[model samples]
Target: MKKLSIVTLLLIVSASLFAQGVPEDVAASAASRPAAIVASTSWTAAFADLGGLDDVPFIAPANLIHPPEYEIIVGDVLKINNADYFIYAGYERMMQSMGSSIKKDEASMIKINTNNSIENVREQASLIAAVMGTQAESSKRVAQYVQVVEDGARKVREQGLDQLKVYCHSMQVFLAKDLGLSVAGTFGPGPVTAAQIAEVAKGGYDLIIDNIHNPIAKPFLEVSPTTKVVVWRNFPDRGGRDSLAEMVGENIEVLLQ
Candidate 1:
């Protein structure tokens, strides 16, 4: 009998055009980390880079049952209500309720309409490591990609963010937020209407952070010629960021440059 990988028991795929690859450094770094039970798709790449599950576990959103009732399992260290979930394999399991709106107190809140920051990335990575139980190996990878993130923010800031009115796709929203850019508007991780695109262009947005994995870029680009577009790799573009931190950090660098 095939052992049912618990992580994949009852979740549905949100769909991925291309699943980002883990960097060779990340693959090697992930060798000693234990397998954790993760509940959010956003955190999957981080875990993959961290070497959480060798088999590539399913990335599923939380089970929404009984009108906002969260069904949590024994080993599920984290559960998602509205925000990101980083479920590591060991230590005491904990759940962080991601608020619908943005705020500072929360852990890693990466949402479409919400304002997620670079700190969220660092927090997410550290929390994942903490959940894995303290070990020489586990602790070794904590804060691994934080420097890169900080560096990216510094670089973007140095380039200056003023005069950059932007519209972003939902997948790239968190990245946009982390860059601390001037975001005039946002749209889907789902289908968006042509009228909506036209409305955004009319708002005088000069930039669009497009997720290459999603369809948001092309149509929106077609909407306005003056609206410059920057591509974001939703998954492992080169599979070499080593960690989510590195991937995100590098992505921000590309977008700003």
Candidate 2:
């Protein structure tokens, strides 16, 4: 019986070692696999870029004025499935179609806030990097994004743009406020109301910072022809500023103009 017990202990130890070796091998394979990410739009792609991903392919065509309204196709689904991470902003029309199809696992699908604010971008980038296991690679890019915002704000101040009374789109107010522009009134993710139009007419607002995605600045421009209309984009335009920092810089340049 003692000899049998010794044999049983040897069997248990061998089983334990084999079991541990299996996980180690699996872990090594997982660690060595290159991360693949597919974004729903260039806006989310920019977030992925900030997280140290160099080749993120997006589903939405960059030419679309409002990318969130883009319909998903079979090709897009294939792209999402082939990738290790599928990143999206929850508002995309495609999300409705993708419902329950994407796994809830953090390693698979990531929903990041599309807001371009420095704080939100930094936070989201860190979150994305944590999932991609690229925090070290992402740190420098994140820092660059923060620096771009700070420098853009400083440039705005230098040009006395902060002194201008501005009318801004609700979606664009975050960037406008960050640049220290004095926003006198705000309007639409929807139609610009009659009351808002009347206010713009007499408000003597110097600038109308409009959203480029769904531009509604025409009415405001007609009401106040003297108010310089500048459309700012949240999504990276086709062949335009591909990075959030570059987009912010371009937006600031538009403000300066």
Candidate 3:
């Protein structure tokens, strides 16, 4: 009877162990289910939908006036567009890089006259006029000074310390040809002599000299000559037809209405 009880106890213990194993097996099967696999796949798709791995997600909140990517630099030529902010940033960067090369015009301070009692308004007007006149005069002087400095620097670069024969040839050969002139002889790899420049100048053709001391100037030293010889100093700030016109000799009449 004791042996039978022992066998029965062993069976009961075996039954309990089998019951526990069944639940564990069911849990394992549930974990490996199609729903769980689908859920994992859906999560991955959702994560991808947030944005691809290559794209950066974070953006500055305070960048309300301009987009986060928009940046400005100095010397950047701005145009009408959305990316103009980047151009502006480029301009600012250029200005920062230019160092002392960038110049700012000084503001004129207003002077107040305290001794005006009966005719205070008139005195004030006179004071304002005087101040304005002084400011204008100061501005003119400053402009002239800047021009002189620029001209001196340009002359040094083109002419050097010695008398150099520099040429200022225009690329508008079609126009020159239209005016009954030789286009092939003036440009390209051909040797442009001093005499050739003189001939072109005589025909009212704007010629580019190899140097400033080109012998063409010897022909016409008059204040108001029939033909003009202009030396254009190319700079980052100036370009186009208007700048080209300005480079032509000062004595020539500007035909712009």
The lDDT leader among the candidates is 2
TM-score of each: 0.53, 0.84, 0.17
Query: What would the TM-score be for candidate 2 when compared with the true structure?
Result: 0.84
Candidate 3, 126-148: lDDT as tens digits: 44334334344333332443353
- Model 1 Cα displacement at 169 (Å)? 0.8
Worst 10 contiguous positions by lDDT, candidate 3: 36-45
RMSD (Cα, Å) of model 1: 13.1
Any runs in candidate 1 off by more than 4 Å, and if so which? 1-45, 48-117, 135-142, 237-241
lDDT of 2 at 133: 78
Candidate 1 per-residue lDDT over residues 1-257, each given as its tens digit: 22233323322111121134558997776666554333333344445334332223323332221111233342332223211333332211122322211122234432221113445544544445454443343334434555565566677688776458888887677667656677777887678887777786675887888766565567776668877788766544332235455556667767777
Better of 1 and 3 by lDDT: 1
148-256: candidate 2 lDDT, tens digit per residue: 8888899989998889998889999988887888988899989999999999888679889889898887988787888788989998874222367888889888878
Give the residue spans of candidate 3 off by over 4 A: 1-168, 171-192, 197-224, 230-233, 238-257
